[model samples]
Target chain A: MAIINYANKEVQFKIVFYGPALCGKTTNLAYIHSQITETNKGELVSLATAADRTLFFDFLPLNAIVIRNFKTKFQLYTVPGQVIYNATRQLVLRSVDAVVFVADSQWDKMEENIESFRNLDENLARQGLSLDTIPYVIQLNKRDMPNVAPIHYLDFILNDRAVCVPSFEASATTGQGVFDTLNTVSRMLLVKFARDAEAAAYVKSQPTPAASPMDGVAAGLRQPQAAR
Target chain B: MQSTPIVTIAAAEKFLKTLEEFLNHSEAFFALIIDRGGTILSQSGRPPDGTDITILAALAAGSFAATRELATRVGESEFNALYQQGSHFHILMNAVDDDTMLVTIFSTQTTVGLVRFYSARTSEQIAIQMQELRADCVDAPLVFTEADLNTASQIFRDTTDKAV
Candidate 1:
């Protein structure tokens, strides 16, 4: 869920980078963390194993942009992509506003990418969400590799949806397309917020019961954020 | 399904101030309001320079999430409260709402019972303010104008330039 805290004049949105194991999800975060100045970014926290595989998730809180006097913050998270970490993946997906589906572009890893995407759908469905509803972007990572599949083929497989969402060709380690992915997702979130606010305004203008100031923190929010 | 809580800077400052005063009066050492994702919404009281609230929030959220899972398996709907008793100080965590939590750290001078009692009340008040802010936000216009978009675009563009 996007946290638009009027009390603090700040808006925070949670963006999760998700993909199969070793698809460069953590690399995406590390690259962005290194690029952001210390003043605008929090310390990057990674819960990983001795071999450096993520055990739980990686978190990096970034605050730089200000929209209409409201400080905009993005809490970027990368779930442990290993198949065994599916439970943790579902946990991390809770309340997510946007997602970056990082797919390994190597031809041999195509199965892993497809399986992960299917798992993503299943996990989201468990939470009553669908890819069709949430604003997301696809990142075809490891594009610089020799064995990578063509962008068009990847798009045909992943982007052939009701709507073909924005997809980026990235080499996360070398920093290619990292910021482009971030920038596009952030803009998409902002646009979505604007549209939702307009709908909320219409609802607010109607004659409804005077809502209990304290009620519906979860129930009322479920409507706007969960709407497809 | 609800919109994110929209907190004005002044309101946030005011709430922090109020929380600071409350902590002092309650004899607590620190207070932190964290969102469900474990992001520090606001914090009060003196913290050591090395205190990383981000990690703390993330861990706390993770702990709560794990504990809640345990609760469900044990036939409980959810665990709304958590307490950890340390050697010198005690910690208390109370759910402010479905998506928010209040964490209090205090010395042994203040008993857990007192902290719990006070924190419960404080959480209620905070929830009211937060929900009201959310309610008021419906009328709050999106003032993100063309200039703001350009500025944002330029800011990201600068970052993109660096990354490239």
Candidate 2:
């Protein structure tokens, strides 16, 4: 979660762009980087290794002003594709405030979509979090393909108690529903954050304790010059 | 279910602001909360920046369970605290009332007194927050994903080695 401080107010949230590999996850980000007004997004840092693979991750920061009083900020990220990157994928699912599960929607990719969706559920369980509890969305990418699955079919598969995660169909390559999907997720994020605010307010009036982190944890955050 | 105690935004802000201040003065990484069962509630610090905390929380839970097993072998029910001092810094986890944990990251640059001073205060603050959450937890059942941790230890170890 990226924390933002504005006029003495702060909001911290996380946005995850989850999808099957090469469903234009990176392309969606590239488009956002090029189109957004500078004040919105942060530096798109991609930590790649010698072979040019996403060794660590890529980060995109964006802000929203929905409530008249509170300002919200989101840290958007894409888990490295490829099944072998499972460890990295697990790590990216932490403290996610909201999720956009982008699906590869060409007709032949049905199995991949289902697998990716299942993988998302699996990872959430590891963190003791579930789609049923957290706010999430579904995005159908590569929608322009000739053999893309019907929207109804894809929707039926994803529907659940946490069912029917809000979804959008877009050709991320052509900059279709990308922004609209983002906007939908961002709005949902604000709604959830507001709930937290309400809970926080109620807790404070009672002189209650807060869940705290270990000492030296935050204070000791450094870039670590290559981990000597 | 009724909620735990409430954790107001004002309270969290004050606590986090203090936390940010502490982070500004120190160079620690990876401090988070662990349950009696080792589930993580929240985390602060810089190490898991790119990595996901949800995943780390589960791993920490696993590590905590491992710690309990190790403690039991020595005739103890649980391990109150655990620390691993790498070449450059410290990874510390302190047990609080069996129901919660206070994990911290430290460096030799700061004196032990400073670490103690901050932790004692922060622990109380976190304890308060936990109580609030407990009062109103919406207790949702979660399914664990075995595949995510499927990396044969060597693969994970290799990645850390490569990163370091």
Candidate 3:
């Protein structure tokens, strides 16, 4: 959901980071929060267990871009990736504008990656949304690990979706490729807004069709249906 | 939730003003209206700088969400109100609508009974207006041109910094 606050001249969007357990979803957000200046970011909040595992979600609010005299803000969130946290993940995914699928690139984690990807699609569908149409990117994370799989194979498996979205090789722990992933997704969301605005303009310019006698009867029928 | 519940600046400010009046009568420290996603829509009677209102809003929303689950597991529909007692101050939260929450903070000067009684009345009054505001929210279309995109891209230019 994008918030257009006319009073404050601010536009806000929600972007969620999702993936399998221990895929560095939280690390990506921590890196971004640390890199940005205090004036450009908000306090990063994490609800986790004693072992530092995410219990529900992590949130970091970033405000930097200015569009059309309005402050463009992005509320970044990371869902709990553990398998048992599926219900919590579904709750966070609601009203999302975009998603960043952070995949663990180690050879041993491929199965977990694939299962999480499928779960993303299923959860999205339950909300009447489709991952195929939503603006998203793939972050192949943990590339610094020795057991990591090759980028080509990772892409062949995860990135081979209907649209073949952008993919980045990232070491989230070291902050490699984190900003790149954020920048691209934010740009995509802005572009999407532009396209939607254009479509709205085109619709407004179109002439209304002439109404026939049946139009009144049809409207009368709708009144009773609406009252019921 | 296909259409975003647009909280216009005008609507939010009006809401805050109303809540502020209630805070005065109830001798409350502050009041905050938050969206379901944990964004602070409006706030009244500011707390000290040491209190991060943004973080407070997020945590309050999270707590309310977890409580909602607990209510359902106990074979209840949902718990519309929550109260937490601190050392010197007490907090009360209520649902203004399905997508919004109202939180009031007060010290020992006020009683929980008074806050709870007045909060329910205020929530009902605010919920009626919120329904009307949400109806007009989606109608305000965002009209962006090429210039907006160019400016947006150039403004966030520091995203490439590799600092961790």
Candidate 4:
């Protein structure tokens, strides 16, 4: 519910990073903030420290080119990676417009990564939103590590759960593929924004107001119907 | 809710000229800038009327006030944005720079394709003006006083209480 006004116009969108501990979620943001011109990004503020980790969240405001005179912006955040931070992660997922799950591509952390992914599904389900309903992407980081779990195995688990989503591979330490990953997911999210606007218009053009927020805003865009 | 009362004559003339130019360039059907209390500072659009805004603002203010209390109780130092959508309208509020609110009513003609782009510019512009207005408001601002409340209550009693 944060209202952002820029250029006398306002555009609001949110992106959340989800993944296991040390999966390079923060690193991706550090790289993006560094790579882009500072003018395009505001101060990267991290909230209080909880035992030396992100206590609440990290917020970075990034501006996109204006369309039709309305400005577009994204608030990027990363959930604390420790398993103990489950409640905080769920809070971050609330009202998220897009998600980028950073996976640790090493053999040792395979189980941790898989469990984190499952946690994401459960959390989203509780909110009545699914990964499928919102724009979601995955990044398999630490590819340079030796004996990393095979991408195929990772794919099998994800696809097997019908959790298929846009994904990439990279070594976050080396800053590879991170920006490209964010850019793609952001573009997809914008497209979803367009779709939502259309749904809003159609809903209003109706002869009468819909019975509920669920009926009006759901738009059948994110909710997977049985047909699929 | 009735459309916002034509702002004070001085405020109305000034806002109308500037906002007309703004609307022409941006092409948003209707826009409003209100204080946190939901008082209409200045507006440009086919807002219903003053009487409507009186009730609408009360409802919106009640919602904001309740949410503020909710946030405080939960130890949330700050309140986030607020929005209410109906069949023909989308009501959006963002706390810009901790003062004034940027509220807009969008019709079907406004597109997501175009809204973000225009809204950002408008937000920034409104933010600056609102800061100044908030300052002036502190000095000698309009307030919905207890007397106004008593008057309203008596009128309601006269209208509904009489009927009852």
Candidate 5:
């Protein structure tokens, strides 16, 4: 869920980039941080081990594209993708509004991709959410590699959901398909948010039905009657 | 799904005032109230030049979450506060509620004892305000039309069209 602060006229969304080890989740963020205008971005913060593997997560804050007089800010995060870091991954998923699943495209990494995807599902389930309920996009990354699997195979394995989500083929190192993945996910999130808000507003606008005598009697029976 | 939290202007003003008072009492260089998810809700006092408050809030929340996990591994439910001592600057983060935290950054000018004392008091006050804010929060619907969505999409495309 987004945090909307009327005081600052700011609406913020948390987007997490999740994938298996060395799948270029941080590479995607680093490229975005370098390309975006300085005024529109904050410092790129990475908590990594001495060997440069992500120890905790990578965070980047971006302010872009105001809508309806409110500045839209995005707090982008990338979780440590190693299997042992599942705990940290779950923590990073907290309060995330959208996700970009960076799937490694190399044929040899298919099993790790599947495992990470299942881990993502389990973590989201712990928060009472699922891919069907949340807006997410799949990025078939490392497409520039020679041993990459075909797009159709990756889609059949990962995007075989109730509804096929937008997936992009990318080489994050070269910035290919990075922005496309981000832009598509962001647009989907905004549209879904708008639709949900509209539905909630409609429900709120409906008049409540008056309780009949039997309903009142049942309510009275459920709770002790107040003294007259 | 948990309801999205909204901080109204009045509520923000109240929180800022509380944070300002905490800064004054503790003589901290900076103070902030960040949600557990790492979004900064309110802040007070001036940060050093070249400091990015947004990153500060995000890192603080991350540090706090990691510490809480450590606490759980040690058989404790959670740690109430975290203190980091640097040679020049120090930070004290206190849990305001399950969903929010109070972070104070100070220098050698103030003692840790004083900052901790004031942070505890301020956390209670902010927690009360948070309770009230949550109770009064109405799911303010975003009245976005299809045109609005199209305009937003166009803006994003324009911004990213030429990658620097």
Candidate 6:
């Protein structure tokens, strides 16, 4: 969920990088953390195992842009891509506003990529969302490697959505196409947030109907009276 | 299905004041009200040198989530609070509501019992205000023009170009 704080003059969005294990999900984050100015980026926190595989998640917060007099901040996160960490991944996706589906470009990893994509869809479905509902972009990672799948073939399998969202070809370790992917997803998230805010304003401007008995009950139910 | 929560100027001021009062009473060096998603909503008191409050908020939220999971695994629905005692500093995190938590950093000088007592009261006050804020939240709508979005995109491009 995007938190727009008029008081603080700040708008915050959560963007998650998701893909299969060893698909350079952590590499994308590490490269960005290294490139971004220190003042604009926070410490990159990763909870991983002894082998450095992501056990929980990796987090990086960036505050670099201002839109409409509001300081725009993006909290970038990557879920543990291993199959056994589905629970941790779901926890990290709790309130994500956008996603970057980093697909491994090697031909042999196609099945893993497909399974991860389906997993993403299933997790979002559990939250009452879908790829169509949330703004997401695709990244064909490790393009610099040999024996990579053809770009057209990758698109045929993954980008065959109702609307083909933006996709980039990149080598995360060397920092190729990293910012392009980040910038595009960030822009899409900003635009969607703006449109949603406008729609909310439109609804709020409508006339309010007379309050009924059910209205009070509904309001009561909405209150978070419990301590926890 | 809930709309995105907005912290208006009035609400923010009230929250800061509440936090400051809690700090004064509890003698904690820092107090932060962070959302469940780990975004710092309102914070008060001076942090210790070399303390990254942003990262601290994120880690606190993560730790709290992990604790909740542990609670569930142990047959409890949830744990309302988490306390960590360090050599010189003690941190106490209490649940304010479903969407936010209260975190305080205190020295060994202050008793944990006092911190807990004040935290419960402060959290209750914050919970009421948060409930009221959610019930009737009205702030200026965030309307972005085409020029604004273009400017934002250009900023990103410029930053990326410079970094590269």
Best by DockQ: 5
The TM-score leader among the candidates is: 5
Docking class of 5: medium
Span of 10 residues, lowest total lDDT, candidate 2 chain A: A1-10
Give the share of true interchain contacts found in each model. Answer: 0.43, 0.00, 0.41, 0.00, 0.49, 0.41
| Deviation (Å) of B18 in candidate 3 | 1.7
lDDT of each: 0.82, 0.61, 0.83, 0.61, 0.89, 0.87
**Candidate 2 displacement at residue B64 in angstroms:** 16
Model 4 segments more than 4 A misplaced: A1-7, A48-52, A159-163, A206-228, B1-164
Clashes of each: 25, 31, 0, 31, 0, 0
Decreasing DockQ order of the candidates: 5, 3, 6, 1, 2, 4
lDDT of 3 by residue, B10-107 (tens): 68777878897789778888998877667777788977457878678777877887788789899986799999999987889998887788989999
lDDT of model 1, residue B91: 76
lDDT of 1 by residue, A1-228 (tens): 776666667777889999999999999999998888778888999989999999989998888578778888888999998998888888888888899999999999999999999999898888778999888999999999999999999998888899999999999998998888988888888778767776767787889778786686767666756556
Model 5 lDDT per residue over A58-177, tens place: 999988788788888889999999999999998899889999999999999999999999999999999888999899999999999999999999999999988999999999998888
Candidates 4 and 5 compared by lDDT, better number:
5
TM-score for each model:
0.84, 0.55, 0.90, 0.53, 0.93, 0.90
Stronger candidate by TM-score (4 vs 6) = 6
Write one digit per residue (lDDT tens) for candidate 4, span A155-227. Answer: 6655454557777887766767776677767767766656654564556567864588676567787767787
DockQ, per model, reads 0.38, 0.02, 0.47, 0.02, 0.52, 0.40
Chain A fold similarity by TM-score, each prediction: 0.89, 0.80, 0.92, 0.82, 0.94, 0.90
| Model 3 chain A worst lDDT run, 10 consecutive residues | A219-228
> CAPRI verdict on model 2?
incorrect
Q: Which residue window of length 10 is worst by lDDT in model 4 chain A?
A: A1-10
Badly placed stretches (over 4 Å) of model 2 are A1-7, A49-53, A160-162, A195-228, B1-164
Candidate 4 lDDT score relative to the true structure:
0.61
Model with the higher DockQ, candidate 2 or 3 = 3
